[model samples]
Target: MTKTFVIDGKTIPFEDGQTIMQAASAAGVYITHLCHNPQFTPHGSCKLCTVNVNGRNCSACTFPASEGQNVTNISKELNEDREKITQMLFVEGNHFCPSCEKTGNCQLQAVAYHLNMTDNHFPHFFENREVDASHPDVMIDHNRCIFCTLCVRASEQVDGKNVFAISGRGIDKRLVVNSPSGLLKDSALDVSDCAAHICPTGAILIKRTGYSVPIGQRIYDHAHIDAVALASEGEAHDH
Candidate 1:
């Protein structure tokens, strides 16, 4: 017998150590999130995955799912809150989707679409951030960084490089390279580094691979992020 929890009336089974977001994703139940990746430790920074657990709001990515616990994931008020969080991400950075290389493949844009966000509700920050293209094979467009720290974790944990880190605090916070000069060229990051590929936004990108996939044939263009995982699993099984 498996232990289970109720999320939006859906009974989701989970192992002892699984969080609500983990159990939900494993069950093919999509709970909205941004700063979450199965390969990395749950940061729960994005608050987009916030859900009502036992009548109180908690981050589903980090909240443990107990047997018989009632979790409210999708609802009118929750979706509205999610929409605001998504909007804040947009305004906090210069996320100009039209001209961005990660447009269709971007998780931020995809999640915005998932939340039915038609406009940026908050005022744009338009903060002038530097774009570091000094690295031969990679580029860092700080303008699009959502501060998810996926790259920071990937570099430190997987690549064992500790090549990326976040600096400052709150509105003044920004990504920094691990180098004496604080430049990508001074760091040891390679194109094959997991950190190079983990960014969910256009903040980090391969140098010469822009627009490699046609806009119409991009990942999100063909399927929503919620279905992409399951669809990819199906394709892998076919192979």
Candidate 2:
């Protein structure tokens, strides 16, 4: 018999080595998260997947799923907290969705819409960050990054290129290029690199491809994020 755990009243089975996220995704359950790319190792930095597991708050992305454990995934308080977290992410960055090319295709935006984030609850940081258009086919707009490290892990794991890394401490945290000149043009990144397109936001983008599909006909334009996230990742795990 398969070992199982209860998440939001639904029983989800899991193998020994699978994390709570892996099991949930395989079972068609969506746990809101930004830092989790099943293609790469789980990085629980976002804390968006925080669930009430047996009266304790733990990151579902890193927390292992065990037998008979009760997990509270979707609740009133959980959804409210997720909305606040999404709002904080917006205020921390310079996200102008109307002007952004990744407006409709962005995961962050989709998550915000999914959680019903109607307005910016907090004050904007408005931090002046870098927009490196030095690379001919790629660009880095630091203002939109939420520090999810998707690009950083994608480069190292998939492309086998250590082209990106997150540097600095808390509050001062920022993405850093691997080149000596500290620019995308100087780095060993190409248009085909996994890191070039793995950003969950508009932080990293391919040049000249902006608005290719138009705003209204984009990824998140029609579908909700719960459906989108289900179809996006997590296929090669212990399914």
Candidate 3:
């Protein structure tokens, strides 16, 4: 039997194990999110997908959908809060969009545009992070990492290689390479691994592929993220 839930006045159906995010995406409802990929285990690390579930906030990605549940996903208050969170992501990282190679195709930038974020609402961290160019075919620009952990999960789950891990805690947290020398060159990651291409930001990039599609012709250039997601990655189901 299919369980149904109400989200922003729309009815969505889900299988027994499906999450709210999975169901909403299947039902063609666009929710603001950052750290969610249907291919990975729902980490619920990014709070952008938090929704009011019967007066309590829950992450849609990890929260299982229950029958007859009322989920407040989209609202003026919600969008405003989400916008602020997106702003903090911008300032906390050195995400100078103009200088970023993933400007047009970046999910963070697309989510910012979707939420109508205009200015950096908080003070910039300006912390100097490393740019790991030690790898022969891949580069790690730590300044652009949002700590989404897609790469870490993809490395372990998809590529069968434990090449990345998150270390430290809170503001001191950062992505670390799994190698004796703590560098990508010494790791087992290959250019063809799914982990290498799973980064949503410019943090992990293939060498010599910058601006190949040009600025105005990139993936998110001509389409809203929601539409693009639907067309390219519609109705995500577990494999």
**Candidate 2 — which residues are off by over 4 angstroms?**
234-239
What is every candidate's alpha-carbon RMSD to the true fold?
2.3, 1.1, 1.2
Enumerate residue pairs that collide in model 1: none
Ten consecutive residues with minimal summed lDDT in candidate 2? Answer: 230-239
Given candidate 2, what's the lDDT at residue 194?
84
| Candidate 2 clash pair list | none
Across 63-146, the per-residue lDDT of candidate 2 in tens digits comes to 999998899999999989898989999999999999898999999999998888899899999999989999999999999999
List the candidate numbers ranked by TM-score, top first.
Answer: 2, 3, 1
**Would you estimate the TM-scores of all the predictions?**
0.95, 0.97, 0.97
Q: Which residue ranges in model 3 land beyond 4 Å of their true spot?
A: none
**Cα miss at 49, model 2 (Å)?**
0.7
Clashes of each: 0, 0, 0
Cα deviation of 142, candidate 3, in Å? 0.3
Best candidate, lDDT-wise?
2
Local error of candidate 2 at residue 96 (angstroms): 0.5
The TM-score that candidate 3 achieves is: 0.97
Which residue pairs in candidate 3 have backbone atoms (N, alpha carbon, C) closer than 3 angstroms, thus clashing? none
Worst 10 residues of 1 by lDDT: 230-239
Two-way lDDT contest, 1 vs 3, winner:
1
Global lDDT scores for all candidate models: 0.90, 0.91, 0.89
